[model samples]
Target: MCGVLPIRKFILLFTIAFMFHVSLAQEGEVASLSQNNLQTYIVYVHKPEGLHSMQSESLHRWYQSLLPVTTASTEHQQQRLLYSYRHVVTGFAARLTGEEVKAMEKKEEVLSMGLHPEKGFWKKSNFDKGVIIGVMDTGVLPDHPSFRDEGMSPPPDRWKGRCDFKQTANRTFVCNKKIIGARSFQVYDNLLHSFSAQPVDEIGHGTHTASTAAGNFVRGANLYNNANGTASGVAPHAHFAIYQVCSLDECSSTDVLAGFDAAVEDGVDVISISMTSLNVGQLFEDSIALAAFSAMQRGIFVVCSAGNSGPSSNSAYNAAPWILTVGASTIDRNIIATARLGNGDEFDGESIFPPNSTKRLNSKLFPLVQPGINGQMLSQNCNNGSLKDINVKGKAVFCERGMEVSRLDQGKVVKAAGGAAMLLVNQEQKGFTTYTDPHVLPASHLSSAAGLNIR
Candidate 1:
């Protein structure tokens, strides 16, 4: 007792059901999803237990069934697989950009003489006159008093020129009334891109190094201290130029090579590089090395650091036969101590006997004590006696080496106790060495005797 359905109605119902089934199948095939149109998501499938029983094609089919149709394109599927495999194998979210990795590697190459005796001896020679010391670190600070001259402004002029290599109109030039010439080579976007036109240093390392190499001795300039500083460069008053080859993060081999080429073209006298790297294979094609060789062929001296990994047998860059590799040493003779007091605190010792009621907190004190001043106290305080007596919590702590604990570890303990700054008194053995640790706030080292007097 059913009425006969129309042929057209039956056909329409069949088509609608077929379309719905197709849509469902397509939805199930998408491999991934992305929020931004420009960005693509990558998906990795987990391996099933005892999956060795399955063939490669069977495994791929199993993964494909979990994705949507839109994401089943060969390219997208490949990307997902690669991303997943890499993540699982490495167990890291993302790797450091090439530039950042390179910068860290170069730090080991940039050696400091610290406070070595031979540091002064190098100044006696005129070798730096024709040498070109390329500081491939931070941007140089143009306003630093160390760089100021008579009738010279603190912040110098900025260089003007295009730096993009892909552009035909690109011309690299830097101008500071004193900066005769400059050339920029921006090749790699990840590492070698120049950020500014001014040849000023954004980081202090470049300034310190440049000053160490060729900065003139200014009469009233406060080099390290406000006193009439006289720590002249190895070759002060020498004509020099800068090759801005480094930034805050990384420097590329390509940029370095271009800078070397420019220095060679300019006929630089000597090349000083404060950078090192573990990629020995890159040295052969390294622009710096090529430039060093070309300069050497023309009788230019190439000097570099022996690296900070001291006591280790690894040979640092520029330690090769063709280059001069310098090491670090201690320079300050006396022991020194620096202490910081809380809001209401005072410090007293045999050499430094301030009244207990004296406002020691909120005060920065550095005492340089000599031998025989507080003979017994100095000997007893060699380890942690001086620091232990200071009640350093919410204050500053200064300790000398020779303690049972590592200097770095001791500094950490002081930091944990709410100390502001931790100064390490140099041990008698190394003489003068630079201490650089990213942890434990701003820190410096003083001589042993100086530290005792400060307490």
Candidate 2:
């Protein structure tokens, strides 16, 4: 069977070693080995209910008897058991070979075998009043008005988390009824970074994500005089337990696992992680995946961001069937900014910045320039190296999307080049998805066809 498959990919998969976990549940899932080729896996045994201590011990004894330790690839190193899941699933997690999987399937206690995803998700909640939500992200801005818990009672008695105040902006980590807990982690002991010692959210990413998930409502909410109005989280009444596991956009797997370890021990209901990588490693070593399995055992829902690498094949991250992945979208609401070309042609673009500081979106028109008109290679992408030669002073610089060119960073680079405004063109893959970012100067994102017509 293996010889009949696509030779290269199949061999690569076996060489790298994929992961799979067997469950005795009635439900079944089919997995494709086409995408993942990582070593190390987590094996799960179904936990049958109504079992006393002795009966549970018997199940464990029977499963452990099947795990025959083999010599690992590393010289003189034997196969090792990484983690034990006794509370949620009665099993041991380890790295096993294909032969081991066949042996496992033959065992009388094993029901079925399939590749389990490291990712997980849930949907359609009954909106339980003020349910606890644990947010594991960059870090939370505890003092931000979005976290204010007004007219709320005390923390749930089951909450066992504590707050950390070191190096915070307010010199203390504030937690009220809505925000039940605040904690930070930095497992990179040997790395060199200023905030390596404490949990402080200097970058506002954590604040934005946490608030968007579970922050309470705040009146007169506006950032830079835009999106001005009342702001509220998707779950306004939901209580939050904030875990800061990332610093400066570098999320450590060890730190993420530590957060999950605490979230489970402290009894969190739901976990919201807005971070995921394009490539996932082995499940046994995958910090988030391993954590999600344990959380699922305890009936916890895990939600994650699907990443912006979409519109391309395999550009998606967090593809593990267990984790719920979310893609961003635009509503029917459109704020029109008319970009009238010099040749009497006009194209509508999407933008959030005003013509001036106190103005609305697309308040006025400015002279637009294509950076490549001066014969600059890679200039249209607006990367750092190409900005010096182009004279974008007092003019809107046109930029194309892709090639490690962050959608938001294009505006920043154009502004730094003394450009008065920006007209960003999207690639065809993006289609009609027009996204607007806060620009240092007035900037708008247009569709690929709109950009071609403008040029």
Candidate 3:
């Protein structure tokens, strides 16, 4: 991953969030409605700057009339307008049916409209000075040496945000020269209450992504004696602010919008979010997309992840074309591991073991076995109860991927079963693509072809 992302290449005219697919709010507008039946869409109302609020309301009313707002909504709540963009693009994002979108499109005030999101790509570039990237993710671990502000200049004078400025575990986290601001949101759907927490990250995901974006340089960085090198963010000299939008599974729309709102208000030049919703479309009704559009109007670059559901067709989220959606690509790096079977067949794979772990294993081989349920090959599941009755003592048991459980849990189950090591096999659909994950025991994972060949 590149260390820091540059905030250049912003378009000035179009209020942009790349369009993805068509929406069907009800049976009449299209054959079938999508999973989200909210009749919601981002309405791109075309108008010049400086229009009166009354004119904007007229446009909003015309759009909202297509589908009557649910009564559960208050007079204020019924105005389910997430963003009213007036600068870069003169439009409002709202819940509109397919017929509404079509009818709204016919209006002279509307520009363009369509489905959800698209794709993101990254290229190698040298870091430039004076960029303040806003990172909206899990949260940052302020104490990691990588975040030190030594030898760095003061934060850019334009920054106007505050530290979440709370104390936790008797430690107070305030912004320094590197991390210019910190905040957290607990909103659920823009109607939730507020709470505070420390900025120190309990989960490493936020720190990892933040560091990759603009972390300070740290020497001797490695993954357990692997990929040894100096560590730094994509734009090492760039200042950054943190908006902790998630402590739960992914980020709720309310929280994500709160993060974007704060970032734009704080004069952030760019926003990078590594969150997405599964089975959700690219409707302006989506909190993140709507907030991103507003940020775009203010000339802030927005970058997001394309998600890890790849190696399968149509498995990507955040495919919005206007937003920069990025995907992970492999480098030349690979962990050195081998799967040697009892039949003298040896195949190569990857592992999370340190560079010197082979010396500890001593090139030893143990009885390799694949445990399954009911002789149906499902025994290799390796989940908690999937192996309780199996005799895995002192043997190297092979586990199968998928079943919606954590990969590390499989290794833990093997270790708890008195097994010496764990051999994980990928599902049939997953190919040579592999990720190095932690394990409770000495373990490695094989590709579908490799594991099947071994079997």
Candidate of highest lDDT: 3
Q: Write the per-residue lDDT of candidate 2 for residues 1-455, one digit (tens) a residue.
A: 23221111000000101111122322112223222322344565654454435465565454555564443333312233445556776566545556667666676655554445433212133223457778877667677888788855577888898866555454666567877887877645335554544455678777777777766778997655656788766666678887888766567666777889888888788887777642455555455666888898898887766665546897655556777766664455666555767677878877767545625434455677787765664788888767877788978788987657787788888988888778888878876667766666777788889987887
lDDT for position 175 in model 1: 35
Best of the candidates, TM-score: 3
lDDT of 3 at 281: 47
Candidate 1: 10-residue stretch with minimal lDDT:
9-18
TM-score of each: 0.46, 0.60, 0.64
lDDT of 3 by residue, 361-455 (tens): 64677887789845745457887776778899998988888666788888888888899888888888888866687567778788999888977
Candidate 2 RMSD computed on C-alpha atoms after optimal superposition onto the true structure: 20.7
Candidate 2 stretches greater than 4 Å from native: 1-128, 166-170, 187-198, 277-285, 312-316, 319-322, 342-344, 355-371, 374-420, 427-433
Clashing pairs in 2: 119-323, 120-322, 120-323, 120-324, 121-324
Model 3: residues >4 Å from true position, as ranges? 1-126, 187-194, 197-200, 250-252, 277-283, 311-321, 342-344, 354-357, 373-378, 385-389, 402-404
Question: Candidate 1 has what TM-score?
Answer: 0.46
| CA lDDT of each prediction against the hidden true structure | 0.45, 0.65, 0.67
Task: Tally clashing residue pairs in candidate 3.
Answer: 18
